[model samples]
Target: MSSPLVFIDGDQGTAGLQIHERLRGRTDLTLMTLPATERKDVRRRAEAINACDIAILCLPDRAAREAVGAIVNPAVRVIDASSAHRTQADWTYGFPEMTPGQAERIATARRVTNPGCYPTGAIGLLRPLLDAGLVPENHPVSIHAVSGYSGRGRAGVEEHEGPGAVGAPSFQVYGLELAHKHTPEIQRYAGLARRPIFVPAYGSFRQGIVLTVPLDVRMLAPHADAAALHACLARHYAAAAHVHVLPLHQPGDLKHLDPQALNGTDDMRLSVFSNMEQGHVLLSAVFDNLGKGAAGAAVQNLNLMLAQ
Candidate 1:
């Protein structure tokens, strides 16, 4: 008749710290963490993980995997906030609003993989269209996203805000090698047959993301058009609590979208903009990367896990 014990594996990192802050002072469960000296102790870390009712992993891909490998207790459910298990077959994806009954799946899942920040936006836009045959499976998709410097995680936070750091670039595009880690995640989850081009940039601001994917209406199916695309997205997220698709043909939609608009919350907004004369449609998603993208997502999954 006691509260559940929750452990955060890498509480020093940005995502972990944020998760801790969100869960702090809550009387529902006990938050557990290792001291700095014992943080790297393998056996101690394993003990902490296996002892918790839930373990939220906010470590790097490698460390996250290792932490998962060390869990011997079947009761210790996990919500990994890393790229390590996103594509894994056995782990349930932790985007509760992603699809129908996805929240129930997260509620019962023993191994839930928290989604990457970029894939959250891309998949949110593409999944419904692909499933409805609006967009072909083999469509060569291209995603361009601008996230605040915090998207880079702790390193980015340091580069932009650390005491030793100064004069951080105003904006910078990365993943020039065309091999970003989020590429496979986006392609796989978005159900695209061909590899998509993802160009992600970092702005000088702290949190939020603006991800845009453009489509050629002419290249789509016979009846597929901008309106149809918008309807598909709107229908998909109509009942969703955290993800909302803006109405089509808004008078001044451009004036409303700012990356930092949803900074403190865990909701995401998807908007479709098009020029009928030009045959080009741009789909964009705006949200707090650290919220819907990382920490808030983990906490949501944990809440689901505890509710059941």
Candidate 2:
């Protein structure tokens, strides 16, 4: 039998380039590409997309949607690496670790929407607790996240890393309007009845992200404490391959967290730190925005599709 054919529609952009690199030399799938001259030609693009068993769209939201529309083959599966269809009911949200049997859904899905970078961390941290009833649906949740410059896509990369670029900032907060693109998806998947307040920022680095959520122990039902929160997350993700829950309260040896610690891999780490006496807890998630957040996720979905 022939190996499954995979085409990456926007293979030159940040997310596309990363997906191409990760899929390079893979044995299970045959990676296909178009020449630069024909990259923008709609006919050529559609042909490439239709010829594949699976097509991965790494373009902007509009372009990604266009690419999906261009596919005429009913058998061609799609993994869209954009926010275009995240909240759409017809498309499966592509975060395998989000729940059990999610991977199987992706494997059979005709359209899979890759999750947003910030939502990946936020949902990863909150979903388990919310499911366990540790965090109520209407809980007043607030998320603060810092991502490397790469999370901004092409313009951000050019501004920070390109020649003549005015690179670097100590720290800067965005989404002041409290209406971020990822908010809907976060609320939907995190099982929140009320939208959470999200504040995101881009640091000087190129990749990786850290998202923090603070909780008050006294507000939880039964007066659940910090350890309970940690235990809930730990138990939920215990069997997950890429998601790990770190133990809370390491005595005096507990160290400060670093955002860039897991830069190159597709793994995401979660930690909970709490002080019952102080009635406070801090839940955090660390991951590579371009990895588990985007490209790695697309590839993982591709693997699931082909495995079917």
Candidate 3:
């Protein structure tokens, strides 16, 4: 039999470009992309999508939805790298390490929705603790994350690096309205009963993310402390290939976390730090926003789907 055909629907955007790069030399599958002149041609886009065994969508929310609607082929499986279907019940979430057997679920799924970049880190940290019952579901949770400007896609690149880009601010915070698109994706998959306060920011760098969620010891289940939280995360990701839980840190072991530390790799490092005296704890996830956050994640999901 011929190798399976895989098509990338929007291979010129931030996430799509990275995914295309990662898959450029692969010999196992046939990679297809429309030329620039035809990328926006509706007939061509629909025909390309309908002809592939797997279609990876890296488009804006509306376009991604429209692409999905255009797939008339019953055998054309999809891995959507957009927020359009993340919370929808029909689309299987593509974060394979999120729970037990999740990878297998993706391998067998016909429609998989890639997790949002921010939600990938937030859900990665929150889900394990909530699953282990170390943290309460209804407890008020707040997430703070800083990602490279690439998280904004092409426009972000233009704002920071294009000609006449002399005065861009070094940092800026958005989502002051507490209604970021990733919030529901985080809450739903993280098993939270209450909505979370998600505060997101973009640094001037190209790509990577450091996402943190602070916790009060008093807010956790009885007998649950920093060590307990660390152990819970370690246990959840023990067998995970790409997620690593760093050894719990003592005072002065590490002073700071550089968001760009894990650039260019798909690995995610989860660290736990605490101050018992103050009854405070901090949980962090460090990874490349383009890697695990966007393109890398889409490829990871693509591999699982290919295996089946």
RMSD of each: 1.2, 1.3, 0.7
lDDT of 2 by residue, 228-293 (tens): 888888888989888888878654556777889998898999998876668888899999999888
Over 4 Å off in model 3, which ranges?
A: none
- Error (Å) of candidate 1 at residue 177 is 0.7
Work out how many backbone clashes candidate 2 has: 0
TM-score of each: 0.97, 0.96, 0.99
Model 1 lDDT on a 0 to 1 scale: 0.92
lDDT of 1 by residue, 123-230 (tens): 999988998999999998999999999888889999999986678998999999999999998888888999999999999999999999999998999888889999
Stretches of model 2 off by over 4 angstroms after superposition: 166-168, 250-252
Q: What would the per-residue lDDT of candidate 3 be over residues 1-308, giving only the tens digit for each residue? A: 89899999999899999999999899999999999999889999999999999999999999999999999999999999989999999999999999999999999999999999899999999998888889899989999999999999999999999985788779999999989999999999999999999999999998999999999999899978999999999999999989999999997899999999999999999999999999999999999999999898999999999998
Error of 3 at 209 (Å): 0.5
User: Which residue runs does candidate 1 get wrong by more than 4 Å?
Assistant: 250-253
- TM-score, prediction 2: 0.96
Per TM-score, the best of the predicted structures is 3
